[model samples]
Target: MFLGSGSFISTTKAPSKEVAKPAVTAKRLMFLDSSITDSSVEVLQLPSPASLRKCALYAVFDGKVYWLRGIKPNINPVSLFVGNSIVNEDHFLATFKFDVIFIFTSLLFLKHDKFISVPQRIYELYRSGVVDSEECSVLESGMLALWNHNVDKVQDRLEYLCQKIKSDGSKDPLLKPNIDSFRAMLEHKVQSLEKAVQKSNLMMGSYCRASETSCHNHVRKNYIDFREGKLRLFCWSVISQMLNPEARSHLVPAKCDFNDISSHLQSTSSTAPLITSGNKGAKQRKITVAKGTPSILGFFKRT
Candidate 1:
């Protein structure tokens, strides 16, 4: 049942069989403020109201997220926020669309899907009270997370290949055999996830992320296992990190034989403009901008 705005609800770090303490106002649930209503009720706040949707969610477990306490964590663990748009009340949700759900007391970086199956886990924090409108966004968050997670693994492997690259050696470090060797586990997982996606576009879409937070709670239960979106476009790049050579660790040579080459590289990196490609098979274009003032010999300089 939906509590009216300003009515606060109370939650524990984990669902505990407490002796049914007096009910607390839902203020701390929807609104994050320094004002204390029920001293016992733990309040969770985002680093700032702007963290909504863009920042990782947290809960009572890591109460006062982004703030480091002692090894034990001094902040209370009952409140978690994916993002906060307000400090005092639902000025943001009541004003615009109410996007956050304040059911669970603790926050979690999605360990489960929208269903939230971990009875003992904090992902359960995000599992509660997800509405129909949010289904896709939730799915997208999970999809985005998993996609990034997969890409991170590839990028990590690519780190080893960095600086190891000599110009005479293979420029395409991500060759088939190399890609095959590193991406086996990722490929298998993607294929497994794809099979999980084949059942329905409802399964394949970006809308309504199927994050299941609890093993016990059954909300769109089937899709929770596979919170994937439009893999065809993302699989290649994510699985290979082929496009991001700069992310790898660089291996600078201890001795530089070519001073001119080093200077040329510095000039190119400093002067290069961003290049962008147009839609399907269009020529790439360079976006140039003047950095420092032109040298006095500018009149003869080639364009």
Candidate 2:
């Protein structure tokens, strides 16, 4: 029969004289099946909160409960507590207390349709109660930005091909093959980039957002420490599309021998509008002065 949450089990068999007494206090608990053997009550001390923040979950289990730890992901076995008999049933019922159980439950509840069993080895760190909502939001946004960047790159390449087709008309026989090759390369690149972005998104989405410490903990647990260099790599990936030959010749490093082509293009493009506007303004001023000068000369002659 299935036991309700916090329900204790009492076997029909009476306690034997040889049976050991229960421990006065339980330092920790492990949630597993109710199989009480001499090795059932293994006491596992939890790590300090600061150290726990970096991990996923902390659990203390006997041999019976320890075996269940393998079924769940992100579970960290702490100190073991050994006792003669089970003390409290409610102690193990707190599913959120364990990182592996929490993650598995969240994934099962939130993403029930897509939930799949993950390896326990992967969840050995136990990172529950760490990540906050804001960090999750940031991670989601980062994933979206990466995905959008990939989409934009693909669209730009498609637009370039359209423009090329329009300009060439039916002239060059090699144009179609070149366009096809370019399209295939772009599709391949987009697929690879999308896969990377999706993996990050899944991790971010799986993160629980309850408190700042929790969020920070989750970030610390699931992700590598935030490095400026990693963010720079992301930025570079977004702008990498502009480097394609079809999008802009000058931006394409492969097409040009010089490394400073993009810088030159930026300098020239930025100055062109200013120079044109200045020339036009000067010509207008010259015309206005010329028109007034004739009147001034006539007045001088009359005087």
Candidate 3:
């Protein structure tokens, strides 16, 4: 009886204690894991009902999360999301990185989806004029279209107030001030639009000159490479020479051992794979052999 009891006690007690370890509760955090097939991108719904009406989703990418708003055209105002309704005048959503806040009522416009970087870049380029007139026009047109829609709403409110004053035949003390405020706002918007157009022109000039310089440099380098054949040096030397007069001598090739030269070329060739390592500071080097005859060596830095 004792031997039989001992065997049962050992099996039951150990198994029961092992199984009794607490189970971990997994929190509903958004995950952007590429390892799992379906975990590359995920949209998380917010908790608030008013905010839910807009159907905003938080997109998870790598470790960062971005908010994506759904926009319905001809039904929603683009300004509602990009402008003061959702984001503030400064376009900041909230104090924290992921905190999203809504600032209006009546779902006045449809939510719109856009890459956060795109509009911001366009705004900067427009303000800077680093793009062409055609490209700048398109950006300005889109911005104005959105701005007009928002301004139209404001104008409509002003007109309604004017009608209210006419119908009542009574001067409300605050009505005149409100009308003046709206008029000032309209003028401010017009000035902003003008500034955007002016900035675009400046940006275009800079962009064109930069593009021409790049093309000229590229052609010059190619000519040199074609002339040198297997003895062509790295393009970084040319760029460095352009940037600093002192670095000009560094561009010249010193007599290096044949094995060292071969090793350096191999190392440069291997550097291409490091570009996609998600490192901002990584450098990538490329050797383009024109007609597979080993002609040009280019080293590009990725920041």
Candidate 4:
């Protein structure tokens, strides 16, 4: 077969056993760019192959080599390439941005089609009390931050979600398996999303930590006491909602009451704004000051 400087072997490292078959040449195979054509197109050469059976299908794009390995037996081939130079931080971050956009677009579409009630699923779950308090709070805060386009709050909520999921799984026996399964699913989605974007050096830090913890638990569970009081997760309840006698035990009084100090300050200085208790624990005061007095709120450290 006629060929150019692109006729090369597979980059995959095959076994040492020599297969009694003619070596597959680059011409026999085809590089099909699904986005461009229904049939194969002329593309760059493959890598140097070590053997035939172990030879993997690969493609060179830009300056890097993409190694395509078939995971499942025969049904369909799924590429499991992760880390390395393919999926980097920028790639997954772009993916996260795209996901955020896609979510909003879908919500908009639903809104346009009179499917607005569907978005209230979280609220329904919240009302039913099926969702835990902390989870509901996180979701509510996250959605509010998202609506306000507050990226920092959104990131904080996402980080908290990761921590909560890990903490819940480790502390609760029934939830451990489910959490492990959920984390595994996330890892798959993360890799697939990264691959779709065609970026390398992707970091699996979020889910990897959870997976490592799971593995560590699996090893340690057999050796250590599971019912140790120190290992139990502290009950999560709204600090303001600690009025119930049963739940009051979990509430630990702070070393010094910020409310008391604020009250004292307000009484001492008439110019100082009145500190009013708001919904939840956040406190905000509007104080009249000489034009641009550098925010009175900055004068007092938020406790």
Candidate 1 accuracy as lDDT: 0.27
TM-score of each: 0.19, 0.16, 0.16, 0.18
Q: Summarize candidate 2's per-residue lDDT along 1-303 as a digit string, tens digits.
A: 112222221212344654543331333344444443233333222222212212212223331112111111123212223366534432332221221221222222222222122221113223233455333333333223322343234324433433223323432111121334443553455456455555565221111111112234345222222223223233233333223222223222243222243343344332222111122343211113322222211211110
Better of 1 and 3 by TM-score: 1
lDDT of 3 by residue, 141-191 (tens): 433332344422533453342322232332321122123343344334435
Of the candidates shown, which would achieve the greatest TM-score relative to the real structure?
1
Each prediction's whole-model lDDT (CA): 0.27, 0.28, 0.28, 0.27
As for TM-score, the candidate ahead, 2 or 3, is 3
Q: Write the per-residue lDDT of candidate 1 for residues 175-285, one digit (tens) a residue.
A: 111323333534564465465445654332221233323344443232333333324323322222211121111111213212233243334332212232223353544
Name the TM-score of candidate 1: 0.19
| Model 4: per-residue Cα lDDT over 1-303, one tens digit each | 111122333222443877543232322323223332223222222211221111233333322233332122122222223446332121110000112221222222222322222225224434456545433444443333343453333333333322223333232111111223323433444446445423443222111111111225345221111211111111111121212221122222333232244343334433212232223344443435445333212221211
The candidate with the higher TM-score, 3 or 4, is: 4
Q: How many backbone clashes does candidate 4 have?
A: 11
